[model samples]
Target chain A: MPTDPKNPSGASTINGTDAVDSRRKPGAAEKSWEEKTLVPTLAKSPERASKFTTVSSYPIRRLYTPADLSGWDEDRDLGLPGEPPYTRGIHPTMYRTRLWTMRQFAGFGTAEDTNQRFRYLLAQGQTGLSVAFDLPTLMGYDSDHALSEGEVGKCGVAISSLADMEVLFDKIPIADVSTSMTINSPAAVIWAMYLAVAEKQGADWKKIAGTLQNDILKEYIAQKEYIYPPEPSMRLVIDTIEFGAKHTPKFNVISISGYHIREAGSTAIQELAFTLRDGIEYVDWALRRGMNIDEFAPRLSFFFNAHSDFFEEIAKYRAARRIWHKTMTERYGAKNARSWALRFHTQTAGCSLTAQQPYNNVVRTALQALAAVLGGTQSLHTNSLDEAWALPTEFAATLALRTQQIIAHESGVTNTVDPLGGSYFVEALTNEVEAGAWDYIRKIDALGGMVAAIERGYPQREIADAAYQYQMEVDRKEKIVVGVNDYFTKENPLDILQIDESVAHRQAERLAKLRAERSSDEVARRLDGLRIASQGKENLMPYIYDAVKAYATLGEICDAMKVAFGIYDEVAIT
Target chain B: MSEKRIRVLIAKPGLDGHDRGAKIIARALRDAGMEVIYTGLRQTPEMIASAAAQEDVDVIGLSILSGAHNTLGPRLMELLREKGMGDVCVVIGGIIPEADIPALKKVGIAEIFLPGTPTQAIVDFIRSRISAAPSKA
Candidate 1:
């Protein structure tokens, strides 16, 4: 007989076979409650829908109790903060000792213009610097390149050479502040620019603390700002990891990011699984490159997105730490405790912001920021209200900074570590996220690894399906996005930031002047040296460092490498 | 009556990779019985214009989120006009600021779709704007 999903095992068979049979069957009390209370209540007032689910489409149980986490062991599953399997948090005193770094990702217009914004945010109590490069800079092109037209200093500041990087941090001391650069594909080259600038500032590499978002896998997976194929790209990432482990003890080489993955319309669980799996791929490649896991793994940091789901987002961060801890110890044989801890930066979900009723975005951002804080994020970036319309205007960016400030100073959430640790619902959800992510890992492992899985379009297809499913839900009114799907409004237009048209002209002129003044022969020699070094087994960071120091523009160096390692064209699966 | 599908070229004209809006509109237009060509990301005005000309698209839809609309918007229009494709309907989408609307419209863009504009509204606009015999060549 075919299995009837509703009543697969007969009522008679549910009574006395084994523990499994008894567990599947509702208890006598639950059955009585369902028959009497639930049925009558439903008949009188029908439930809103046949089923309810989280934003990620995970089913939401009506109520959770200790029974939901029946087999969960406190020691094994929910160890104390700063311990192995740190589901509670990575640090013993997560926020009591020091709060998360208030980092606002701000970069637009010229280097001088963005430098001013940096000073303003720093004066307004922003703790860290996160650089957002313009399109040309992000894709390894000079400001004057044909592809860089109309895009110079539009999205983020355009930094084409060490000179621009130096101007970007004019008065800001690299020694005192931790900076995060959101650039990949050409991350190795861009990071070299930053290092050269720091060297000019007389800052020691070991003492300079910062993070480089050198996660090219995510670029191929979501961001699509890639210049080279995955193989050579992975080589560049490993080179940085090896270089950082040896030299820059304080700097985090790769911020394994799921922020863009979630922004590209992945479920929360997909974001978690794919991000950790990417981290695993990086670790495996590094080990293959002859680096010890403990040497590089401890410095590896993560970046995640804090979406609108409050409890779910909190559980994701907690579960990520736990999963990373277990994977490092059991799977990779990492002996150092710090190597097991997953330190991460969280940014409020830019995807969740609605262009309608733009003011409502402030509330949404506050809630998401609170979720990041409650989840024990090491650093945070709150999106501004006007972000969905344009890059945040100065006023809007200030308010976004204030969101993080209010959470840190005003809110009493920082008084305890893992304040929601004992809640049955939170604990249960944490385990569920871990279990779900492990299932994805197993599938990826079966396909050989993440690279093999990516080649076959596994995660990409999963995210696209999830995105389509969500849009359908919103269209069918199954899900409610305030001010978007429901609670409609005619948004009174807000003041938006407009990049000046002269930025491109000014940037091109600067590049032209630099090209005239710099030693062309030195640039050519450095680039050729970089090209030859890129083809060999030796690390390319030293060559990139030399090239940047010689004032070779980003495009020049990247084109040189392109000669050795050809450009990447994405396999279109959509 | 046999109707040729509305061939629309959708191009991302800047470095911003937030394609949720682009992908959504592409699918919506495809469902609405239009042939949409999606140029993935980081396309220059030159590349976009070249693609539009080669594809012989009746409509060119540009998506820009980087606030470079003032610079790129007019550049694309001029490039398209230079390519002798000025008759093609041009629609602009993504985080376009209100202050820049007059300038973009002044440059001959036929429509501007803000973030909240419905996908159906876009489909209807494209269908209504194109002439009866949209140049199939």
Candidate 2:
């Protein structure tokens, strides 16, 4: 017990011997309780397991109390919502004012086919759109390319040129809907096609809003969809940041992502550390390109994965905001408060889904989505139940969307802002996660930032090790994943959505028709200009836009740049 | 007499970059006292067949997650036979649906491992299968 002058009731005053001095510290109280009460109970009946840990295998304590947060300063560590450090929340009135945008990542088959799915999702109350390009498009290949076999539209929509992009958006008004494209390697070329579509729709460039997953650093570290080497890829990213700052004022040029990194098997702390470090690396590059921090930093958004472990996920997001705030204002000298605030879109962890007992994934996804909402995400994409089997079917996708809707409309958790802000466990865990991430940042800084560290295979090795350890833990039954390792049951396989082989044939035919109709001379001249520009220090977005306007294929534009910047081959490590 | 250790060549065919499973399998195989060579991401069928031949591996572990297994799987088998390495133990692991597993086996994929499979199970499967067959070496 401790006496507090602020307590008018004198509740803390146990005796009249200098009230405050007569009380024991919380640590002493906890120690006494554990010895007298906990030891006797534990001796009588043993606990269920010898040890407990989070999904990441981090140790979990028996309980969290004020003793855990000895160094926490309320006003300094966590201020009011919509204020500095942003640990509580970004806005003062978080979801009470407006709910997060429900953006389901949907794509599979030709542009026409995926367009139907997009319209269906929008009709079902999806507030935003996220395009999932097929493997060929993600790898910068046309549907007719030799490497595109059996993969034309299996994973996502096949967009070969601006013609395909136009059909993808079809009747959708570009100015009204905010779109997010999950493209990485050929992000510049694909973004040009998107801008070309918006231009044709008479949408003003400055008014258009969306996010381009233009994070190439994470590609090398985790996703492995990289085309050009790190040096040239970074140049392309900085070019987009510069161009977007000057032109598309509302669009986020780069969504520095930890989603793929986590999906590739990283701990939550690793995801937080590497993603923010990737953001720092981009800011450094943009500064070298002669751009002010406030100019482009405001448009730099982030994407994270809302995995299981509810408290850990929530703490990760809180720590992310606080770390970003400190880095922007103190480290980079950003003057704009908008630049200091870290806004992110979260998707339920796809790696957490199970192929066996597929219906159980619905429950997992709902819980993960709830975690994203509680973590103060700006936008959320709930993964479908059948994703582990294949791309989501219409029924499954709708159920995933409904999960988010239930949380927003039915769950009472959204009525208040940062409801878990004052919890002892959450606040302490936020500080601990932040400290773990700072250690990684310091290590990466010693390795000369993320790019150099990636080239050295530091982060990749760390993630691989973490992944292997987690798998081993699951194998040894140390971690119990329901319906996976334990609680075993045999069930019929779910009916998954399949892409017909004719999709490849149809996409090839469309590419041929476009080639035959478009101007060959204009395509060649524009490609020649792009090739020349790639060898120089000029901004390549305009050159790519010109090539896209002339109906040059995605593969052709990427090939033009490949002529100047050779392909990068990473050394495989196990 | 010293026993010959199994040699595994883990290759990622096609353009998909989901290599978490592949890398984990490679490490597991190595930990089980086998020599492993991983052909990194974006490797085509021809590249994989050539790497398997060059590395002189006894088993070719193909990881395809882009649903291109129906095409890439058969194509790699043909390439291996053309390279006179038809006796190689060809195994595929990824998000292979149950309905497609039979067709994959028909195309000469010895085994298909889906998600949530234990690494020990994979290790045991490889050992039992490889020892049952004649050693190509």
Candidate 3:
């Protein structure tokens, strides 16, 4: 996300008047409709009143008549859904015909433990599988590795091999349920493990479908998980894109993610802009590899963070769709409408969770999830109330799922298409977020795209500046965080979930047994063949599947390549 | 003694390579006129302690979001004690539960700043906690 020296925090640009500090006006805050006439509205007359505001603080006007979005040509800017420049949505009847995939992210401890969780979620009626690999796997290391000792499955599932991934999805119908892995640096290997699991189940390559958070650019900017230099990383992404395009067309090769970037403290616009920029960078890499834009582009998906801001998140999504549409159709010459559509999965803001007043996170998450739904997310995940404490407990996870259900069934907001689209505030904020994001997109273009900007530490610096400034505002009491800086109560009343550390030891014991039971010789031959394939131009998925089927560990496959490509220790940006 | 730069080591020990907190703190400390040495992501406790020893930093700022802080923070403090660097201040910030603070403090953690603790407080804590460079008396 580009940082304007003027509006550095993105959320600070709008004057404080947008949200009347509820602390000062109890009557105004409590009285919803009748007593709210004191608050000025630009909708009454745009020229007479101040503009609406995005979460990032970008000023949005009260009304977006054709005048607000002045130069935007309807045919050029706002095209029909599933058509080139898919500003509306990828599917015309987005939630009307089909409910978005209920993909809850779940995984913790060893592969078997996470596997049990997958089956549980599936049994609980989850439609899609989403993987949350541990820090060790995300950082490209095996569980037993000293660097990964206690970290094995602390944050997510510890996947060391096809053996583990197999345990993870045991009886969970990989062929029937589409899966999405939130792995980046080791995404290719992890994806290969999933394919191996599917193959062992007698599913063909074309039949297995899932998504990989293969967007490595964010690794440099926020996530800090990269195995190779940008060049080789781009090579790995192109390999997957090309492979998926040719074989499993249903598979989403890459999920351009803004979740981490936002979690790393980027403002809403930064998340939107940086995420879109990373997507363009991937397309450029694939295009350079001689793959047609439409072939791989149509399968590319996105992941976003639905933050605490209600209207801001909705506007951010609308802006993302518009920006991606224009960038793909106008910039990349994406002939296919599918290529232009910005189909994205959203998760409620985990960063917004507070360890203080932990139950407050549920209300925060519900609001964020509703924003995601109204924003037209293709899929959504609601963070559990107790996630700020530890991996969600069964009770907490159920509540999180129920939160989504309540929004879907109880909430009638979905009765209309683009429910918030015509709002004077939403449309204006949508245009503002889009403009703010383009400011960065244009700068990245000037600097020769995301790869070059990353090399120059542009995105990294921009995110830092925004985070720093936002912190400054929060500290100065300019921004009111309910329990943090303002209205904070010393007597904290929140239930925090506690997971026993013994879970890891038990998981490791099961894993060691799984490894001992598998044939070592088969693992060796398959892994050796994978290493050989890596030396050449073969699409690495088949070889990866073979290695995974042989019960080869993710570490073995990543280690072979780390020897060739070397691991990426992020260059300290500060 | 003149206000010599406060040398701080910002580390991500034990693989929850979440450096956002560490990075923000580093930038804040640096802006506050301190010399910050950031050990990049995925550093082990031994590696972090070794770097702190070699660098002779006045403060070790451990950022652990992996929930391994319970195990990792204690281990680092014990290693610091073993290394005869017990006087060196150790401050940790992350997703640490409030209940664990007393136990961590008992192990001689100089301070534990949880998430959302303003960066200025950290800057101030470091400035005040890092024993003034032996007055040239």
lDDT of each: 0.86, 0.91, 0.78
lDDT by residue (A1-574, candidate 3, tens digit) is: 2234443333332233344222222233333431354233322422332333444555443223333444556676556666655555667776778777888998887676777888888788788888888887887787777777667777888888766777787887777899989988778888877776777788877877778889999988987778788877787888888878887888988999999899888989899999999988888888888888888888989999999888889888888988888888789988876787788999998888877667778899999999998888999999997766677887788788888888887898767677665554576567677888999888899999898999889998888777777777777766667788877777653455455567667656765886789888888788778777777766777777677777777778887776557666657776
lDDT of 1: 0.86
Model 2: clashing residue pairs? none
lDDT of 1 by residue, A1-574 (tens): 1233443332333222233233443556766766777666655654444445689988666545555677889989988988878888888898999989999999998899999999999999899999999988988999998777778887899999999999999999999999999999889988998998888889999999999999988887887888888889999999999999999999999999999999888999999999999999999999999999999998999999999999999999999998998899999999999899999999999988988889999999999999999898999999999988888999999999998888888988999898999897898789888889999989999999988888888888888778877876776667888887678767578888878768888888998999999999999999989999888888999999999999999999999999878987665444
User: In what order do the candidates fall by DockQ, top score first?
Assistant: 2, 3, 1
TM-score of 3: 0.89
Better of 2 and 3 by TM-score: 2
lDDT of 2 by residue, A1-574 (tens): 1223353332222211232223324577877886677766655655455445678876555567786678799999989999989998889899999999999998999999999999999999999999999999999999999989999999999999999999999999999999999999899999999999999999999999999999999999999998999999999999888999999999998999999999999999999999999999999999999999999988999999999989999999999999999999999999999999999999999999998899999999999999889989999999999988899999999999999999999999899999999898899789989999999999999999999999899999999999999999989878888999989898988888989899999999999999999999999999999999999999999999999999999999999999999999998778
Please name the candidate that would achieve the greatest TM-score relative to the true structure.
Answer: 2
- Supply candidate 2's per-residue lDDT for B64: 79
Candidate 3 scores an iRMS of 1.6
Clashing residue pairs for model 3: A10-A56, A11-A56, A52-A60, A115-A168, A160-A554
| lDDT rank order | 2, 1, 3
Q: What is the docking quality class of candidate 1?
A: medium
TM-score of chain B of 3: 0.92
lDDT of 1 at A392: 91
Which one is best on lDDT?
Answer: 2
* Candidate 1 Cα misplacement greater than 4 A, ranges: A1-37, B130-137
